[model samples]
Target chain A: MKKIFLSLIFLAILTTGASAQVKMLSLPQLQKRISNPDTVYVVNFWATWCKPCIEELPYFEKLQATYKSQPLKVLLISMDFESKLPAVKTFARTHKLASEVYLAQRKSDQELIDAINKDWSGALPGTLIVNGKKGIRKFQEQEFTYDELNKLYQTNK
Target chain B: MKKLVLLMLIAVSSMAFKLADGGYKVGDTAADFKLKNVNGKTVSLADYKAAKGYIVVFTCNHCPYAKAYESRIMDLDKKYSAKGYPVIAISPNDPVAEPADSFEKMQELASKKGYTFPYLIDETQDITRAYGAKATPHVYVLQKTAAGNVVKYIGAIDDDTENTKADKVKYVEGAVNALLSGKQPQVTATKAIGCSIKWKKSA
Candidate 1:
């Protein structure tokens, strides 16, 4: 019984340690994952500190579930620090989100800022809707409903 | 009838150049607003009536673009305030949404950076909307004339995006110099690119 309890404690600590580190996404890795010709990629820029981002997260989850069979990929890219990777994973697990979660690990904000959009002013709670073939549309805001999200997809398409 | 329709389309397209509703025009008397400054004291635009003009900048704490212009803005205030164009910086971001842009934190930054100008906070964001400010580091140069306060120039601080060295044009500074020389501003408005000011969510 003591051995089993020790193993359980070890597992708990292991998960906790894993949760704290942020997963950084390289540009090449991002390009590779999102380069699918069939999918319309919805890349959301969010952080735990942002309330509006938290509020609108469930809508993205719902959108993902609704279009699971479709060629739609919802990628939730957390702008949180690398050290907060574990906490972000916990947040994702707690919220029961099915969308692909990524930690955008850039050394400087400017690096990601220029990569996303030349016009991007580096605001949180931003989003990038990429057709992967046509073009990209970026938004800087806190809250957006499922209807708004749908409208963006339709208009872009 | 086709000619008339084309004329109407052209006229409608030109109308986009004018200020939006409730926005400050070239000759509108700017309404006075009391905002908490970096010093923890209230500062108003009217208080600078002693000056010939004002360099009103809407900026925030968290935006990287805002940070880029921090020193340049200070320098502009320092150089121009002596020449009668004082700079008044306002932060329009909601404190609850952006804690770094809160009043107390603004005060701290101003103190630490030794800001020569008033870094004001638009608590309700009314001042921001009045100026039609869309991004951080957005600039509006107003010259107090016998007629009223005339907006001389409204746009980006300079031509550089992220690199200060890349700045080839000084739009606001140039307009201020022209105003100081009693000449009409050459460029009235240009597109401003920066972080969008965060407005408070309706309860």
Candidate 2:
């Protein structure tokens, strides 16, 4: 009942005005974004329902803001199923997420996990920070604070 | 120049290895735990004297993936408990980190689902750490032997997380069947997406 109510509100908002666009990123598109040498990509694999992932999202936003003058981009790639895209959009809009969020509609979840980082155990709140210009990439599966995240970004950058 | 490139490659490879490290491998002896079940009874591997094996899963109430596989996990017990392998599920997430997965909630979920298996809580997370479980719904299929409970398979419930696929691979079932037929499973391990085990904050 709550889901239906939320969906109706989301649909109403969608028709009345433009909502935050949550694009489905293919594997190739994702790889391109991460491998782009122009900027460092902090790709966070998360979902709206994941508590720990939600807890750590602010730190990513803080990282993006802290290095606003630098070549850094924080991409919040949501692992939510397609049916939840409306909710995802609503979340972005309501929360006012500064980071860009893309729905990970891949061929398979395992494939997506492997594509992001082979060592990752397909856990939520996983991050892959890539600095293509520096030829460096680090994959970590843990919750992070702004300081911890900033230190990792500084090393990769 | 060649030496510098080689050094970089080495460092990168090691880092990759370390990220996926610290989990139970197939053939390793799994540790026995004395955990509290939903019935308020302390359960352990030794309690199941008649079992030939155990399907020990580290799962929690809060994870959607775990919820998706919940019925299938029950099916595993229904299919194998009489055959000597009873399912034993351990809720590994810290209640502090996720209030929905508290001991009370665990009991509520167990009763609601009418779980036939023991849904235990790892209060200290010692058993969870011992198994090196990184995600909810992570499985470790153990085969009882004179040497102790030997881990025969370590991975997901099946290939299909959504539970709607027609061609889903049952990693746990295959492993159990192999043991029943006196043969080792071909696919010993696999990876599936799941929520990370929420640990208590370090004070």
Worst 10 residues of 2 chain A by lDDT: A13-22
Model 1: colliding residue pairs: A19-A86, A20-A86, A21-A85, A22-A82, A22-A85
> B89-157 in candidate 1: lDDT tens per residue?
999899987898988889889989999999999998888877877668788898887776777787777
> Which runs of model 1 end up more than 4 angstroms from their true locations?
A1-147, A154-157, B1-22, B25-28, B164-167
Clash counts for all predictions? 5, 0
B1-203: candidate 2 lDDT, tens digit per residue: 99999999999998755643575789888889899999999999999999999999999898988998999999999999999989999999889888999999999999999999999999998788778898989999999999999999998989888777899889899999999999998889888889998888889
Q: Best candidate, lDDT-wise?
A: 2
Worst 10 residues of 1 chain A by lDDT: A14-23
What lDDT is obtained when candidate 2 is compared to the true structure?
A: 0.88
Instruction: Report the error of model 2 at residue B59, Å.
Output: 1.0
* Reference contacts preserved by each model: 0.07, 0.68
Q: Tens-digit lDDT track for model 2 on A37-148? A: 9899998989998877888888998898888999999999998876678999888877778678899887777777887787888888899988888888889998888888
